[model samples]
Target: MSTQTQTETFVLHNRASPEPVVHEPAQEPEPELSPKWRYPKVLSAGMSFFVAGVNDGSLGSLIPYVIRSYGIGTDMVAVIAKRYGTTFAGWLVAALSNSTICQYLDLGPILAVGAALQILAHVLRTWMPPFGLYVVTFFLASLGQAYNDTHANTFVSSLRGAHRWLGFIHAMYMAGCLVSPFVATAVASANQDSQWALFYLFPLGLGVANLALLGVSFWDRMALAPKRRRHVAGMSGGVAAESSGKSALMEITVTLRTPGVWLLSLFFFFFLGATITAGGWMVEYLVNIRNGNVKDMGYVPAGFYGGGFLGRLILAEPTHRLGERRMIFIYAMLCVGLQLVFWLVPNIITEAVAVSLLGFFSGPFFATGISVGSKIFAPELRSSAIAFVFVLGQIGGSIFPALTGIIASRVGVQVLQPMLVGLLGAAGVSWLVLPKDAGLHRD
Candidate 1:
């Protein structure tokens, strides 16, 4: 996920110069700026990830409450499937539109729009909207997240020591995931009678703050690009639109053609799918099969996320130091063992500890993948490629959860274990399959 050590430096070619700088350090020096004032935008981007993490993290804790509040029946299959289906749709829309949108607009307006959509979703949810509308809110939230986060990640992963920054932002995400369950569980159980949906008020407040942060930090890039950027300079409107469309199409085509993109996507496909599935259903499994209390079980996922928070913080540099490929595979194997402990062992306490440890091992997976991807994907295709990978990963995130819910609605949530095991193992194998030499056009 990170660069090789000082002995094996990356040779970043200067586009303006003919010579390559072979002696540059793998860990790039911090940008020369005031000590107190480096990149606040990195913090802003991290907050965006945190907001998304809050939104996603809450789901695992809230799933049981949603089913109970909705008074769902055998059609629970439809309910869960449809809920995640909307999530799938949101990612689908992002996949189709992110590249085109970036072609004409700056990241500022795009991020602003994404934050606004999330705020809108929370607004609708806090009122306890109808079931159908509630599902629609997920679509809005995810679409917003896709836009807001994909770009933020792309921007961060391009910097010096991109791995560390990627870890910071993604670790912020785990922090949100960690904080969310505590708040969600507290709010939900505070007045389980009628205020479960009130949990959204929390994310709603954060969403507003996220938008303000993005606006202030990204002020310069908030508007659409210059006319020359949107089109050929001096071209008429119709031709400009055509030119923009053609350019956007070309980026997507090129991004898709890259083998490294798809290989990374494969790793993400299973990794995200497994994590989302486990998080989304762990509460349900504990409550049903483990016979745990609904109120108490809601807090359990905090352990998972908390472990993840520590893992991302503690593991990023080491993973880089040891070797991203070998270390990730090792972590993946550890996760499989922990998942087995969660499964075979009947003690709820054992399961809880196991899940937490499982999370710790799995946490580095995301930041590491992105750091490596930045090196492997072409710069021109960077934004669209990462966007594609992210949305595809979100697709995996949505699909497995929906599938689990659908199957569990029939066979019970016990199936979550085997599914997770399989996906985790698949993720390990996929990581091993990545090209050993990590850099542009390694495909």
Candidate 2:
């Protein structure tokens, strides 16, 4: 009956029981919830495209300001420098995405990394780095855009009603382009000559919002930890890991060898060359060649982008229903005719109208090309194939504008019209040569 004896008896009783009373540990604090859009995945993806549009659209308007700030006569050389950087970064992403790296990651983290790069680019621009260093920002921004937009393109292409969605996203891009010029022009026009660099602050804010949305919308898929592979009855873990790497390489090699990929890439090589050249140089072309008022002409590029926005919105379903192939050919011809008008006309108002009409005709070309690409390649090959085409497109985007600038510095900016005309012709031809049945609805 001693206290020690009683305690010992109680312990014995507890130990002897079939199940002892159990106490749970205190629950850990839940992590803070992230901010997110209430909209679904498709809309989130569209927002990313809109961000890209804003980045791209604003450039044409900003070129005059950039030229003035840097005391450069022609901005084309700077554009080439920027594009060369972008082209290199784009190819780097294409190579890595095709390599074993993608096996361990998903699209979301890739997008986040891209967004971060863009943010850094804007931050650099906001400070107005020396001209040599300033051009480097384009490369950073282009590389980031390639990563983020390529994956977003791939994702949206797989969903139902892909053509409509493709139109929707590209339209968002044009919409961004339309809005950016007005803002950029307004800000630059208001600021002192030394303060032109401050315009980058607007995009810097947007880039931050872009990264936040990408993080939230893609949270579930964002860099999910790679699962450990269960060992086969006789296989070693090292061998399995090695085989995984090899498989990734094989997938990329197979994608590279696809004929459709090469043909599609060739088409975009010309297509994007035309698109970027027109948008990037329009303001300069108008001011210098058309006797346009510098203040008023800065808004001309918006008309081009606005036309594109309307074209994508109005023409998406028609393109799908009328047949993508036939419709594109018609669009190309119309674009050629519009360019001729823009080129031959001496009046600025006439030139502006012609440019907008050209944009309207040219707008569906990109989204439609992607739609066709989605159908031509196998699902597994789609991402790599599209990435390859996009990289080539960036090369064209860089090369032609640089070429235009170089030639313009010699013969004058008047050379842009003829160069664009030739590109449009080549693009039409490239599209005609692609395998006609690759996009068969069945498989």
Candidate 3:
């Protein structure tokens, strides 16, 4: 059932050697990177996702305490929430900009910049600032994340065993999310007022670690850089000034004209929305509606992320056997059922189980879509496609979090369960329409 084939090998003999040197026939570019086991690249990328997960999960868990510390109303908290949310928005812009610049620059430098930004932003957040400063700092940090994310997705997807690698990266992120609640809570319990600041230390450390790893691993890997071609806009022979203006727009026009990019973007829109909404809302829902204890509430989100790890481990081979389309649809349907169980049931334990099941089963869908996009688009378009989809997904992430706040402010946190069901349903529909062997398409 495997779509993969063993490559043919050719033996070569040198004048100095009695034995032949065998070289395997180079295969079509893999959907993942060469030497996928290159430990450093994997480690760096995993830490990146991990930092993201921890940041997201801890911030959500810390929201109540932050509101209390600032002596602000829930409305003021929402305004502060924009600071965190703007990071994602800035990520979108960075992705687009990186895609254009990747033509002329190495992805490593871009990622390094992002890591530095995260360290600076987190440091600023820990120092206690005005709401506007908080938002601006995160936005700047998020721009860096966008660069790292798009390049990382592109780089990782170009390797072998993509599903497993993607899963590992995402699982690390979940692991970060899983750990954050406990860390944040333990800190918060001690200080009571300024606990959120303590959580920044972890990402600050990770950001530094990632910078070192990236410098060593990819410092000289620019051969893998996206190819750049110069376009001339003169009409046979024209004043250079007249042609310069038009060529600038042409760069953006080329990316916008690709159909495959737009569809992939739509895919990311739904997928990221589902992920962020679930991660951001689940703990709050449990604590608020189920009257779950804050000390115990840490486990609920961990369970969700734990489920993600399992999904990644179990589904990698099966997805290859069954194909991406069928597997995605199956998981999507399963998520819907799980969400219903979380919603209709009133028991906290049962809700926790359902939420975890939902998180575990659903994590692969987002990572898989990225793999699919890698296969479906041309290499020239791959990062841009990734950027397009990722941006849409973040837009979804932004909208759902803000919406959940509104809903929680009005009807209650329990609304998240039912609303989540609808979102998962939409994701399944999107998967159904996704092209088969999507990664194979030349366009």
Q: Write the per-residue lDDT of candidate 2 for residues 198-253, one digit (tens) a residue.
A: 87888788889888988877776575323212232365868767876776788778
Over the stretch 1-443, how does candidate 1's per-residue lDDT look in tens digits? Answer: 11221111222532221111111223432233332322778898999989988998987777777777887842353344333578778877887887678766776888898999999999999978888898889889888998887788766765556667778888899899999999888888886384778889999999999999999887756666443352467888898888778877887888899998889899898998888888778998899999999889998999999898888888877887777788889999999999989999999999999999998888889888877776776555666777888877766776787778777878988989999999999999998888777442221
Q: Which has the greatest TM-score? A: 1
**Candidate 2 global TM-score:** 0.85
> By TM-score, highest first, what's the ranking?
1, 2, 3
Q: Per-residue lDDT for 308 in model 2? A: 92
TM-scores for candidates 1 onward, in order: 0.90, 0.85, 0.83
Residues 1-443, model 3: lDDT tens digits: 00111001000111122111111012222233334436677778777777766776776677666667777654444433633367666866775575446544566666677778877888887766776786677687777677777777666665445556666776777787778877877777776345567667777787788778878776654333333212233334354333433432454566677776677666566666676677766767778878888667755777887787677656655665566677778888998998888888899989888878887778677677776765665554566666766676677677766676676777887777766887888878876666554333211
- lDDT score, candidate 2, position 311: 89
Candidate 2 lDDT at 398 equals 75
Q: Candidate 2: lDDT of 185? A: 85
- Candidate that would win on lDDT: 1
